[model samples]
Target: MSADNRIIRVIKGRRPKVVVIGGGTGLPVIVKSLHEQNADVTAIVTVADDGGSSGIIRDYINVVPPGDIRNVLAALSDLPSLYLDIFQYRFNSKDAFFAGHAIGNLIIAALSEMKGGIFDAVQQLSQMLKVDGHVYPASNTPLTLNAEFTDGTTLSGEAEITGAGKHIQRVFVTESDLNAKEPPQAVNQVIDAIMNADVVVLGPGSLFTSILPNLMISNLGDAVKATKAEIIYIVNIMTQKGETEHFTDADHVRVLNRHLGEDFVDTVLVNIAPVPSDYLDHQKYDEYLVPVEHDYQGLRDLGCRVISADFLQLRNHGVFHDGDKVATEILNLAFQVGTMKKRRY
Candidate 1:
């Protein structure tokens, strides 16, 4: 049966604690659907974003970028739709001073200052926004994403790395400070979430920039490796430019495994549907390259239980994962594995 057609239901009085790790546009959709399914959700977002409004805000405020966290907060929030619309509203380019800044980003930046850190600021905002579940920054501090290209050149910052237009060897992150070489540390609460979760999910975001930055953190990656929870990866439906261009689904899994130094992903959800020819608007959806190719044998070689499904949703000429279908499948996996899978740390 297709994942969407699967008639899975959660038992009463039982909430499967699910921890989602990643950043960028795709993270919120999954979180919202899981929240609707009554799963206890915790989002661990990457802090390495340095582009557009987020980069501008990060430059001036010296706080962890709030864009990803803001989106996740809105997604899992129980607030009225009108309230969230106001929070998500953005200034037009004509308004040069505040152009492109979401009201929610400004609020998060303010709270970060008042709360003495982005982590605490998010906690405060989560309560105020009536967020349905926990939202933790991958690390309490700002992290700079750096990439080494195939030609042996290095670029720092998300924009530069992607804009370099070269094949990537690998990507890593570090504290934005000039003197720091160590990976930014994830907060203890994030580690606790992974260890206590019944399942941990990665991706449907930029494999290197959006997803890997979180896992690149030493403590967080270590916790993910050690956790007893089922490790699931929701592979992106389309390849991203400058990273994962022409990357097969198996190549995506391989990069993730190489970074963490283990075949840590227990399961992978791959989209089997096809995008129509020339369906994407290059001007509007410039970041996407093409549909990701499949390699079931390679995934099996990596020891992943590959779950293929028609999880594609096309809107505004852009491709996105069908959140409801993906969520149902994940909850089914959680139930299949049973709730007793949480590590006894």
Candidate 2:
């Protein structure tokens, strides 16, 4: 080979770019792992959450969901525990004020109100935390998540939607055709990151609420489909009681295809390792871990590569997806596909 050709190849073999979309702990695990792989990462988080501490702040102070955003930021935190712990600290007081709110959530709320925009507040927080990657709201619009059942029952709000006692036949926002304004300018940065990315990750969270909600956005989905990047959907290890109910791996993919298209997700990550029966949380969660969906064969048949890994984790309060293990699988996938321009070792 020529000397100039070798220099060009060495220069081009730099770190990869990654974009992650979704809420909950799942996407954070992937982000933490990918961050270590020396990839340029962007996390486009969902703003539709309207429950728990996030809901309280959203209602009283009027801001995008901060709980999920905080979780993601913690996962991306590279510095010592001092800063991260302070941000995550919760005031446990008998007083009516600051009872259950995390200091991080309130900090975001205060900045958001002070700055007059949720996206701007998140950027400021990101800088304060010195988070490893860029994080942005999927959309700046304050949205109410709507769920419609097969029987035609309609539910509004994330809390009520989870308790409908019926399978979510379809999920959409109240103003589906709102001509919803473009996603926050920060999101376009995520898209631009994707344009330069080798691969993008979709989920390992709630299939409908966490993953699909972002894609349902008019412009976000368009950017994803148009990007020259490979997209992967990290399937969940267990199905939620009222949410997925009895969803299989194939059912999850079908739901994705329904939203984006048949070829929307390039690869589907599955858990092939045997989960210990003792890991099941029937007593607390009141539901069994739904078996891995039988759609692995079908996914491979349909032209999507199905990569299996040990993606399960046992935690006391949390559900599934061990952060480090899930991150390892993601790095494995990225390296296997040459999507991440980094050495695995």
Candidate 3:
């Protein structure tokens, strides 16, 4: 083990159990960094996706969308680079039948059909891929995201909700299968992970579509509220156009608290470093708007312990959280919490 890993083990007497809840491109970046730090990570991925290759597959096969899950699996997999490349490879547009589909998404779809559910399929594939940690879809079945805009109009499906271009008032999830008797609920293992985790993380993903879908599952959200784990919200560096335009960091926290019906977030990680003006390629990343403005007092009023720092990383003319830096802060917080529990006992 590396010195840092050794120190964590020695201090905590075990690997810190971290449950990261979210989906989209940002979730995997942080997951990969936490794996490098030797934290026992469990990624609770959102399955409310209804876009891109995942949308096509879901429409045809009646299965949970696999794009987000596939990315998270790649982040945690210990397979060779060549193997991962092949798995993540997307077919060219000229290949009419397979165009825009990722190899991993196809594999996941096949596995889900064979295994009878997404949870089992992902677990089986995790072993096959030599994944370093656990990956659990927020629910056992497909979930459709529903949103009520500020104008009081409602929409269903993640794609439709996002494309409406209206201010989202609130978001919720429902089973895509209207005939299903039971409401959407996470599996036992997912609940166990949340209840037993040392820290539970939310965000660095879209506030309405990516993060809230998972939490809107009643059982999962309840577990998060009741868990002894210190809940942390990784505030987005930039405001998203269709979702969080003109939103401050406090607005993000406020929305989360409102959705969950409590001020459950114990801490917030705010990126204080400003994005350079006219630096972003707007054509490439049209979804992101301006940098999220700060509201320290507003955050404090929400009962959040705000940690502000230079957590900015500028790459390819886009701004993002420096995963390594964010991971370090998370581990430090986990260590402190673990030590306190040990001392009290």
Candidate 4:
């Protein structure tokens, strides 16, 4: 169905509940678009980040990395643009102690300290920012992402794993706290959102670091696999050199299924539009190597419904998914799922 018709249908019924799971710049783009579509959006942000200001904060404060959560908050916030700009502001290198730190990250760190937990801190800040949707941290505490590479060597930390430059065999999460014996798990709200969602979306972010960190949390992955929500994977526009070099779209889905022990993805959104030659500024996006290759049959063999389209958006010499187009497709699928549920009753 057309996006216009889907929008009309959605308006005549209850808003679709969408739960987007991932981290990085790509996630906020989709979350913001879903919020614009009037979907009841919930973002389950990865807390395994251990780089930049977030890493600094994690080392010093021993709290969840606030970078991704801060961006997701800005995306869903109904606050004025100026306020968001200030919240998102980064200190210059000259500002020694605060250099590279975002204002929102500091605020989140402070709140996490005062509120006694990152999840509670984010929720309190959400209300203050007049956020239009929920933003839940993947865990209450910091998580260290661990990877076992094809060479059988293991690495801990998201930064270390990515920098190792090895073909990853599989990845998992562990509590950053050495003293903590318990396994990592998402808070109840995150699991509830997944189970109750009309649609659950993953990716447009790093396959291992960004998306899978949350799923590596045992119960959260179980909820996703067992949930009735139509799971959608937005295949990345380009394969990353260190992570998924020479990977096809089906290879992406394959890795996801292998990790979770099930072929749980219901739909795969692949970008068919070709990027203009010489348009990409490689220095700015050094990690991305080449456009991901297509393998439709492989995807189908894994029980995925492929939806390839012109979902590409080229801007400022960077390639990205067109947020509006992707959101439209998501909403259409969500509405279809909703309709089917109603008919069954």
Best by lDDT: 4
User: What would the TM-scores of all predictions be?
Assistant: 0.94, 0.87, 0.96, 0.95
Model 3 lDDT, full chain set? 0.91
Candidate 1 stretches greater than 4 Å from native: 1-12, 179-182, 340-345
For candidate 4, write residues 1-345 as lDDT tens digits. 222423333634578899999999899999888887778899999999999999998889889999999999999988888999999999987767988999999999999999999999999999999988899999998999999999999999887888888999999999989899899988999999998888899987999999999899999999999888899999999999779999999999999999999889999999999988799999998888889999999999998999999999999899999998999999999988875642111
Candidate 2 wrongly placed segments (more than 4 Å): 1-11, 174-187, 286-289, 317-319, 335-345
Q: What TM-score does model 2 achieve against the real structure?
A: 0.87
Candidate 1: clashing pairs of residues:
none
Arrange candidates by TM-score, highest first: which order? 3, 4, 1, 2
Q: Candidate 2, residues 149-178: lDDT per residue as tens digits?
A: 888899878778777678888787543225
Question: After superposition on all CA atoms, how large is the RMSD of candidate 1?
Answer: 3.5
lDDT of 1 at 139: 88
Worst 10 residues of 2 by lDDT: 2-11
**Total backbone clashes of model 1?**
0
Q: For model 3, give the RMSD to the true fold.
A: 2.4
Give the higher-lDDT candidate: 2 or 4: 4
Cα lDDT computed for each candidate against the true fold: 0.89, 0.72, 0.91, 0.91
Model 3 per-residue lDDT at 138: 97
Which has the better lDDT: candidate 1, or candidate 2?
Answer: 1
How much lDDT does candidate 1 score? 0.89
TM-score of 1: 0.94
